[model samples]
Target: MAKLVERRPLKAWERLNILAFLKGMRTTLRWLLKRPITLEYPEARPYIPDNYRGTPTLVKDIYGREKCVACQLCEHICPAKAIRITPGPAPEGFSHIGRAPAIFQIDRSRCIHCGLCEEVCPEEAIVLQKEYSFSGTDRNAMMIDKEELYEAGGTLPDKYFKWGKSE
Candidate 1:
């Protein structure tokens, strides 16, 4: 058996729930009066920090020669295994006469942008640029060859190479 206790009814003001509605409206109005921070993308490019990392590239020496010795360190260290290289003797007339890569390729689709290849490169042949916008219709189009890497790296500034040592 249970007792049936009677309780008082709710007040009329409490039943309307006006406070919650007013708070919501106030928030909406406050936001409506604020200005947006968006920019016209094509006309004005967004600010990229100095330390920002975008795409990995293969750099060259000051003498306009390929810097990579084809050590395959980057290929072995890449977590995504996006890098592939074929080792060969250095090009004719090259002063270094060291081992170079006959074939160097990287699959952008498989790259995770971890920056490990650049960090581990002893010859400082690989570096990451600030280029962020790139599009490809097909998966194979995303693959980058040795020539493409050289082009993407562009010309390294004199300051980048100091005391015959690349930075």
Candidate 2:
């Protein structure tokens, strides 16, 4: 006696497709006559949703100071280690000044924009902003410096958590 091999049955939806094909055709025809939803490049631009992560924004602290204490928290948090900071001296009247970074840089060539730096920053010195319309001519120009990042980024909130004001 020969034994028959059993096979799994086809899905119910796939078993019957004549009506489905007609419905799909009708939908396609309706779409064909409708207005085009795509925007033409070099002439038109699409809308980006709010809170979209586009660029890394640098923020300052209260008293018109830099929020970063140069603790190297963000640098350590960055998986790519794209962040570089060099410490500097602090102004007078503060004997307990912590490490102050004179050189802060973020290499766009390697940055993943994971927002880890922002989340790990004890001072919230950085944030992912909505500035997505950035373009560069060369690799050298893409490496953002401290002053440039601060200038390009939006102003930090008037009072951050460190300043004792609630969000």
**Which candidate leads the pack in TM-score?**
1
- Candidate 2's TM-score reads 0.66
lDDT of 2 at 157: 66
The runs of at least 3 residues in candidate 2 whose Cα sits more than 4 Å from the true structure, single-residue gaps closed, are: 1-35, 40-45, 91-97, 158-167
Error of 2 at 27 (Å): 9.0
**Candidate 1 Cα misplacement greater than 4 A, ranges:** 1-36, 162-167
What tens-digit string does per-residue lDDT give for candidate 1 at 40-65?
A: 88678889986677888998876788
TM-score of each: 0.75, 0.66
Residue pairs that clash (backbone atoms under 3 angstroms), model 1: none
lDDT of 2: 0.76
In order, candidate lDDTs are: 0.85, 0.76
What are the root-mean-square deviations of the candidates from the true structure over C-alphas?
4.3, 7.1
Candidate 2 clashing pairs? none
Residue 72's lDDT within candidate 2 is: 81
